[model samples]
Target: MGRILLPALTLICLIAARYLADQVGINGLPAPVGEWIDPLRLSEAAIWLCMAWVAKRAIEVALRRGRNGSDEERIPSIAFDFLGVLLFLVAIIAIAGLVFDQPVSGLLATSGILTGVVAFAVRDLIADIFTGIALAIERPIRIGDWIQFDEGTPQRTGRVVEMNWRAVRMVTVQGRTIVFPNNALSRRDFVNLSLPERHFRTVKRIVVDFSVPAERAADIIMSAIRATPGVVPSQKPLVLIDELVERGTVFSFHFWVPDYPKMFMIERQVVENVLHFLDQAGYAPSYPKLEADIAWQSVSEIDASFDLPDLLHRVPLFSKLSEEERLNLAHQSKEVQARAGQALVAEGDAGESLFVVLAGLAAVHKSVEGKLCRIGQVEPGQVFGEMSFLTGEPRSATVIAEIDSVFVEVERGAMQAIVRENPEIIDQMGEIQASRMNAQEIGDSTDGTRELDDPGFAEKLVKRIRLTFGQPG
Candidate 1:
């Protein structure tokens, strides 16, 4: 109601001001030439004031509606801006005609001639003006869309910040605002990152010395990328050896990220992860000789070792056990190494052991008929074969070593012995097993046939329970 009344009040004030100006009589005041002041005519003032108010109201309403509605809603802003300018011009002409009492025919002729001359002189500017109107109507780029323009040489990549009649303003990655003429934008080849969808694929590449084996390099890089916090699993990050450069081998890390306004942050994170991983692996960016010498001296000769005492001391699962119990469990565990492309476990095979990866990467694949289909990959600090060990079920998937991998294998009998002695271990195992099973079930139910409740629903139920009983589940 207030929104509606404000424009009405503004119109009334404008009319009053115009009339009062015309009626003011200066009896004893000396006025300069061409400064004759008089209040506006009643009809003329009313029309002018009303037009101004209506134009202002239309602009406000259009902007509000545009923001609240779909992309199509923004079309009205262009109409409002054009009509508002037209109405304001009409009000000015009407008021001027009333003030001087001159015929409008002569004024129209003069204005039309001046407009034609201006248009002829500034054809490019006029084209840009019309192009801007077309841009507004078509909406090829919206506010906040990430776009790349002028692909050759030094490219201009930025997010659209504002659009106006003459030009579009883009805020670049370097924090500079560039104003490009609408006509120029229409002529250039531009890539709208926000078009069709608001998701984009970003590929980052890291060059590592060639001395690092291809398989080992890929494993380290992929593991680092997957472990990076902001990265999503759905994007399915891929690490490929793109090319062998003069100085080193280039590994292309490709993944999809949300097409956000500030994409430089994500790019920075990817680069940081790549550098961190290479540093951890003791590999330099350039020169194979240095990396080769370092690998040979520090890593190649290190014998396969699994510190049982350290594992029990670090892992939460074995933390509760006493030193003697940890030692006993460690004694039962065996260190196994599988070379690249080796199948550690086959689907439907009888498995009596659960493996905890200590280092290197493996993939979990299922044999559909005769061909192996990769379901997922496993990295360090992850465990597998728990389903077969706990339930004595057949191995659900084949675990294949993607790189030379090492793991600590605990036999079903040894795990059973440990759990039998410590019943608390069974409860902990049940919780872990339940979480994994739930995740697997959710992942496998792509056909919408599963009846499991969503986590959001469960969270709501838990919140209600907490509110009612003052305790949480």
Candidate 2:
């Protein structure tokens, strides 16, 4: 609306001027005014130019409306700019022929010669302008698209921000603005990360020791990628053995990221989480080594790979427990393996134990409006089901294994003695459970901070835990 205001006002003023010109005859006007007005036909030329501007604005507005005002479907700005220039040129020629009553054929021929000379002098600029027009029409890459312009070492990736007559401007992932000449851009091969869909598949390769079974490694890596936040979970991410080299076995991980601009952030998170999961499972990435005997885990790290106590140490709920208490809990706990799609716990079911994910992934879901909607994911080292275990309430949410998963289940039987010895541990457990409950109730907070501790809720939770375990009031 703001864009059309100037042109609309100009058109109104031109119409008024034409009306006044006719009412007050040029012959009755002063000598110089009448003399200049008749030859120049100033009023008529002004009216023609104003009409052209108004028409251009109207056409642009109609194009936008045709797309239902969707930013993704709106015509590129370069298209409108080119259309305006073309319309103004046509209006200029109309003024020469009709308003001035002059033969425009000769004028057009002279303009053609002048244009040829200018085109020859600035051929590169003309080429860029024409190439930009072609790109605007073809739309191989649109504004807001992520593209790779140079695919050499240290590849160049940027989001298209603006396209004008001679150049395309993009802001890189590093926040640097880069301008590429349209003709140059058209000549090179480029990749549009956003085309087909904003979600695109990417792969990462990691080397694991040959000592680790390829099937186990593949399962672990697939679960790690699937558990990541930005990954498209419904697509079922895959992992395959790519090669066997001197270092070890190369495994390829394939997953779809929901957006291109977020690719880097997601990649960082995937790597960090994947490595952590592998470490929890007692594996490490193998480096190029010539030695025939390659140890997968060092002597110090071997216990961490297999010991239940080591896994217990990583759980946040057990953070307050002493080393001896954790070992005692570990002695009584049992390891359970669940296949993909298996229900670990069902909503409203009886459960007296909490489970900690040791490998693979699981999803937390609850019945919302008669539909089971997924609420969260469980990754390696994370604990779940404590509310039902501590309070003996019906399971508030159902948890299902997303992939072949391993969990260490600690029943109330295992924890009874530990809590009885140190009642203070109940306070810490209450604090942790209260934070989890707050997170679920609050959803994700925009401020990037969660309610870390809720004393009132914690106090109530402690009582529930004591009652559930038959501890003293």
TM-score, every prediction = 0.54, 0.72
Per-residue lDDT of 1-473 in model 2, one digit per residue for the tens? 88789989988987887787677754334677766556337777988998999999999998988888664575777888889999999999899899888789988787898999988999999899889899989999888888886672124788888888889998887788889999999999999888988888888889987666566677678787876788887676778888778888888888888887777788888888789888876568987666687566653364334567767877767888888998899889887889999989888788888888777888888787899988877777777788777878777678899889878888988888988898888878877777666666311111123334545656777798889888775
Q: Give the TM-score of candidate 1.
A: 0.54
In model 2, residue pairs whose N, Cα or C atoms come closer than 3 Å (at least 3 residues apart or on different chains), thus clashing, are: none
Residue lDDT tens for model 1, 418-465: 655665555555454445555653111111222335645334433432
All models, RMSD in angstroms: 12.9, 6.9
Q: CA lDDT, every prediction?
A: 0.65, 0.79
The regions of model 2 sitting more than 4 angstroms off are 28-40, 152-155, 288-290, 294-336, 344-358, 363-378, 381-399, 407-473
Best by lDDT: 2
